[model samples]
Every structure is written in structure tokens, then in C-alpha cells.
Target: MSRAQIAPPAPSGPARSVPPPPSRPLPPPPVVGPSTRLVDLAAPEQPLSPHDPRSVGEYTLTGRLGSGGMGTVYLGHRAGTHGVVAIKVLAPHLLDDVDARTRFLREGQTLQKVTGDYTARVHGVGFDGSMPYIVMERLDGPSLHAFVAASGAVTDGEMLTRTAIALARALAALHADGITHRDLKPGNVLLTSAGPKVVDFGIARVVGQTHHTPAGNMVGTPGYMAPEQVTGNGALPATDVWAWACCVVFAARGDHLFDGDNILDIARRILDGPGAEAFGAVHRLSPRLVPVLRRATAQDASDRPRDGAALLRLLDRSGATSAVGHAGWDRLVGGGVR
Candidate 1:
């Protein structure tokens, strides 16, 4: 069957709600013992070749930022403007895949719909032979994933509150532009000196794009994907919101809510398990934040907060607004928070 013709598997229970399993005594908090140190999470595992050629067009490569399943991201600078930026050069093997190229270009176009400080700004695109590349603003900060790993967990109520606000505002802009960021995770959020900036719009979908996945497949970080995304149905603004909640949960607890050996197993647990137990380990989290998290992580998209606005409202009601204001948000963005 063609890729577009594949159908997502049907969900087993009610779309809106899944009854929780019987309550058991809450588990004790996991021991917070020191482990091996990872001081420089932003440092690339391998240094960039100093002699690597610059982009064919206007930019010069300075250093490597990071590499992932798709490609290597580099720190680059535009010649005339001397503007620093990040560019993702698609993997050589992926250049042979028509679908992958199309998806990459789609991401560049869709990101234009989202405009805000919290979302990375896409500047332009270039090609080095058949390998397509995208140019984005250079955000000098560690990913939230790295921050959480180094700092243990974000137990400060004010920090979580501000982070939620920034993320919600960013998602609101994307939803307004009729785009859905299919992949939203800690690794994709950069904690800059100014504040949190969301990056990596690689797997997003515009409003009218056909949404389908190969059978028995899914395309998102396993622990953070919404139920619909996990089921391979498709993602919407609600899916982003669900992932946003998972991000907050990760920041608050320093552990993934859904634990499994692999993506498929994690998907099954999120679809079928009673997740209330997952929140129990987060003792440092304020009680007021629980309901907001619960709403954000609702099994059904319709049952979750309708949009970023609604999520922001819930956060406001939780009395986090005042704290965010006094927390030196500017200094945090300036790289002082770390």
C-alpha cells in the first residue's frame, strides 16, 4: 500500500477517558543520589572538522552543534550580515528519500507560520549538492534535556511556572498559524539565558497536509507523544499540548512518566495504563499544578486544554503568574539561570 493509504490502528477504549486502576499506597520518592557528572551537555560528542567546507552560498561553518537521527547541526555565520545561526544539513542517505526531502522542506515552510520569541526563527534554506539544509537563529543555550540532566530536577515552582508560560505562548503561535509540531520534547527546547526557546520543527505538519504513517510505525519521542500520535493517527495542537505537559512533568520529576524498554511498549502504557501513579513521585511539585498537568495529559485531545490559551489560564489560576514576574526572567534568558 502507498504511504498515504495506511490507516492508524483503532484505539481500544473510550476516546475521552480511561478509568484509573485501583489506587495503591504511593511509592516513596526515588533516591536523589549523585551520579556521574555531565557538565557540558551542549558540547558535541565529536568536534567538528575545522577544515569542513562552508556552505556553498552565503554562510560559513564555524563549529558543530549536535547530531541526531536526521543530520548534523552546525554553528554557521552569514557573510554579509555576520549573523550567527544554526543549520541542519540533511543526512546524505536521506537525500535519496523523496519523502524525507519533502518532509524537510515542509518543516521549513511550516515554521514560517509560527512567529514568536520562544520559537526559533527560521531564516532561510540552502543546498549543498542534493543535501538540503535549513538556517535558523543561533540560540546559545543548552537543551532542556541537558539542563535537567545536569541540574537534577527543576524543583523551583517559579521556574516551572515560567517555563510553562513560555512554552504555552510558543505553542499558541504555532496553533494560530495552523501548524502542528509533531515532535515536542525536552531535547527540542533550548534553555537560553533569555528564557526557553522551542526548536526543531522537523516533523511538523501544516493544516492541509495528508497525515499518515507507515503501518506499525510512529514518529515522535516515545515518552512525550500524545495518545493520538502514539497510535499513528495524526497530531494536532492538542498533541503538542500533551507533549508540553510531559515536558513539564519531566522538568518537575526528572524522570519520564511512561517507562518502557522501547517506543512501542511506552505507547502501549500511555494508551492502556493508569497514569495517576506517575505523578506520585513528584513530591516537590506544588499540589496546585496537579490539575493543570492532569488536564494537559488527558487521554483524549478534546478532553485536554483546548489550546495554549486555555493552558495558560490554568497556570494563571494556579497562582504561578506572580512568581514568574519576580523570578528575574530576563536574567534567566541571559544564561544566568543555569
Candidate 2:
């Protein structure tokens, strides 16, 4: 199929893709119930950091796992079930901003609605003072980004196939809930012993929510954004498919598909230039896969796969497998970042 034609931008260049109409406003935040806060009987005695003390209902904070623009994630344990959970504590400074808090809370609610082993599970949520925190299943694994960084480009066709399957399943679960994981980069995909688990839904939007992301405001990771996303058009399931294709390309070649001034520029190049040549150097990949990747990364969202399941089927048709027997999983959990 021919790629979607780009509309001209004002007087020159391709035309900009128009965003879908805003949906209804998201529902009010769910009320915190008594069960939401378990006893701190097994809570850790020491804080993960001096800045953010570890105390949220019954979960004890062990150490700081990671921090991002939104908040810090802590390794915590729940005494009730002896379960390890990752607690996401929003920055205190953001409490006053209703939009930020609503987005943060929406992440928790969105994950809770996604029921699948490929997706992270939300256990509970509470507050440490005005800072909101969410308790989630603590996954022992490195993000796909970290794995690629350590192992270099994944040349083994089998490993790439496994990763693709896990990710596709995760995306399928997300779409089933009427949710779109606007962000689908390597960093957001965690590789655990059980399997790959897709995490980080801070920028996700439910189908019917009206709080449309503003134009020119990008929400996903730069290198993985779809062409339409770069144009400031809102993302859909197809957008996730485009990013998924980028992930596959990264696995095969260990490089970005576009080299533009920024995400928007990259999107423009992918839409208008010979962007499919980015994967030319990867010899391990099947020649047939090249066309599939090109279509997945098509400038128009409509040109991509219908959903994650469809993507998974395409990857399966490639016939790839894992070279090492779960060694990647063990190394990821055991390796410490200094």
C-alpha cells in the first residue's frame, strides 16, 4: 500500500496531520479505601533517600529504584502478602498542579485496568503527606533500553522474536481496556524472569477521555514516537504499532531509524525520506521483515498494524527465538547500575 500523503505545512513542506477531537474528561479520582493502606509491619526501617522518606500505608521502602520527570520509584515490600512492590511517589512540588496529579493518578488507574502478565500490576495507592504514591508489583528486571545498551544490538533473530511477542501481547492487553499507551519505548518495557512487562503509563489516554494532549506537546520518548506523534497529532493504537516497529529496528540494528534535528524532524524524514534504509545493515533479520517494518513506521497511523496482536503475528511469521536460555533475565536482575 502507498504511504499516506503528508499535507503541506502552511505554504511549504508536507501537510500536518490533524489530531482527533478531544474525548470526554477523565472520571474523578477513585476514593482511597481502608484496604488501600495496609499496615507498615514489614516496612523498611531506613528510607531509600533522605529527600523521600519511605512510608506509604503498610509497604516498607527498601531503596530507590529509579526516578524520572514525574516522580521517584522505590522498592517496597508489603507484609500482608510478603510481596515486593514498586512504589511511585510523585514529586511534592507537583501536588499543587491538578493536571500533573490527575495524569499521575490516571497512570495507576490505567494499569489496574490492564489485566495481563505482560503488564505491570497495581497493588495499592496512598499518600505520604501531599505526595501521592502508587504501590505496584516490583519487577526484577532491566528495561529493554538497558538490555540493549549492555548487549549491544541484538543480532539473534530468536531473541528479537521473543521480545516482540512479549511486547505485542502487552500492547494487546492495553488496547483491550480501551487504553492507548502513548509511550512505548525500550525504557518503558521491563524484561523480567517471568517475561517482558510493559510499564510507565504516565502519558497514556483512555479512549473516551477528553483531556486531549495539546498540539506541539509530545508525550512519548523521542526516538520511538510515530510520525504522526512527531507532527503533534494525538496517538492511537497504530501509533503504538509504529513505535513497536522502531523497537524491533533497534533490536536488529541498535540504532535510531531517523537522524533528524529532533523527534518532529525525524518524523518528517520517516514520512518523506528513504527512512526504511536505516535497517539495511542488519544482516540477521529476514529480508521480508524489512517491508513489514516500513509499513509499521509509515507516516500515517492508519497505515500501521491494526493492533498489537497483528504485529505479533507478523513477528511470529519471521521465526525467531531466544539464543540464551533465560540468561538475559538473570543478568538483568543481578546487574547493578553504579
Candidate 3:
């Protein structure tokens, strides 16, 4: 689930295992073992605490997925239907914060319209009594942040390429719909069985919306924030591209390229942009990807690729030039980028 206290969590943890919710309960899939590429498998959901509700709207709360500063996500089951879902409810304290409440609901509404191979599906959004809540299809896997931290960098070249492309498309789709996922980082990319699905729109905005955060306050994870974000100018689609490039590098190298002692230090480096060493790292692992990231991480947003489609085209060209040929690209993209 997208979040607070959630950090792209709410049923998110490489360590935690969850059984298929009543929803989409296929026969048990093969157990994920040490040899498996994924970090998680069919496992038990965390038990709910006493304070957790027994039910929300039409869904019965079954277990705890996770919690964040804004709210807790519960594994929910509805009567008369086999569908199981993750339910995110606004914290009681936020009820009086009109801005937070409005934004929370807006996230739900916008998310409902955004669905494809690239994103988690939104099922419902409503007020269960006084509480505002969002219901989403439960995803079974770890975030890219957890995956890279636990397993190491995405060393498989083809998988890495596909990951870079899928994630780029996810953001592209968001921007196409006027939704900007302001917080695009490894933590928000879920490494699911189907491939990577980008999640968490907590800080996202529809086009032309005012500043999501108060003036002078930071909004995204520091290492991944774009220069525009650091300068407090405004977040653009290029801003997401900046974060995406950093994440791609992280996937290749198993670490963040920017290092700093504190928030201010990190912010300073972000504004300074990547150095020669960063490009060198990509050059060692994926020479073709270097230029794509080089442009994406440009200090000036104008210098970056225009949009996701533009990025996709760049990726296609990069893939074409790489050892992986056109037919290979087709298989990697599950027939096509659709």
C-alpha cells in the first residue's frame, strides 16, 4: 500500500510472508526457496493488534499488513466474496487536518484511475464511518529497496533492463494521466512475480496542484530527490526521472551513488547532481544504460528526456544496441510494453 509510517509499506517487508488473501486465491504456488530470485513467498500475514478493527466497511479485518505515521494497513476480507484486500485507514489525528484528509482521498481517487502491469490496482475508496480508507489489491513481494538490501543489486542484465523499462513506463503512465508520483524511489517499486509494480502515491499530485508540502519543507527521500525538488522550485516528470536514474544505478551497484553525513549534506549533493564516478559505475555494468541515466540525472530538467515515452524510446534504442536483440526484448517485456 502507498503510505506514511508505511514508507511504501503496509503489507510491505521482505522478511514478512503472507498467504494469498481470499481474493485471487489460486492453488498454492511453488514455495520460494533460497534459489528463488524473489525475496519472499507465500507466508503468513502478521496478526492484528487489539486496537485494530474487526471490520472496515464491507471488509472484515483479518490481519496486520503494516503501519505508518498516517495510518495502519489491515489485511481485509469481505463477506460473500473471496476477494481479500489491503485496507488503509486515515489516522484519527489526521481527521481534523483537512489538507491531509483531502489529499489522502485524492490519492485514492487518482490511484483508481491508474492501473496496468506497472502499478498495484485500487479496488475501492470511501469513508467507513468517520474514517477515510482506501482498499487495494494486495501485492505479494518485496519492495525493490528491500530486495536490493536483502539480496544485493540486480545483477541479471536482462532483468535489470526490463526493470528499468517497466518502472519508467509506470511513471510515464502516471504523468500521462496528470498524476505525478512525487516520491519515486526504490522503496516504492515492488518486485512482484509479474515483474516490478510501482506503488505509493502518498505525495503525488495532479497537474497544476499547489505545493503538496508547506514552503521550505522537504517532501521526498533525500538521496533520490531531484534538483528541482531540492531547490523547492516544483517537481516535474523529469523529477521522477532523476529518482529513477538513481534507482537504476542502485540496482546495478547495490548502493546509492550519493553519500552524505546528513539531510543537508544529501540535499547539497542532489543539487550538485551526479559526478564522473557515478557514470563510471554504470559504464562498468551497463555501458548502454549510461547515456540514458546521464540524461535523466541532468542537473537541468530541460536536459533530461522529455517524458516516459521518450525514456522508453531511449531504452528501446539502448536495448537494440545491447547484445539483447529485438526478439529478446519482446520476451523480456511479456510480448510488448503494453
- Please tell me which predicted candidate would have the highest TM-score against the true structure: 3
Please write out the lDDT profile of model 2 over residues 47-142, one tens digit for every residue. 355555656677777766665456777777867766677788876778898888888888888878887777777887677667788888766555
Residue 275's lDDT within candidate 2 is: 48
lDDT tens digits, residue span 217-278, model 1:
56666777788877767777888989888788788888777768755677798897336566
Instruction: State the lDDT at 124 in candidate 2.
Output: 72
As for TM-score, the candidate ahead, 1 or 3, is 3
- Report per-prediction Cα RMSD to one decimal: 10.4, 12.8, 5.9
Q: lDDT order of candidates, best first?
A: 3, 1, 2
| TM-score of candidate 3 relative to the true fold | 0.83
Question: Any runs in candidate 1 off by more than 4 Å, and if so which?
Answer: 1-41, 44-47, 211-216, 281-283, 323-325, 331-338
Relative to the true structure, candidate 2 has a C-alpha RMSD (angstroms) of: 12.8
Scored by CA lDDT, what does every candidate get? 0.67, 0.63, 0.71
TM-score of each: 0.81, 0.76, 0.83
- Using lDDT, give the best candidate's number: 3
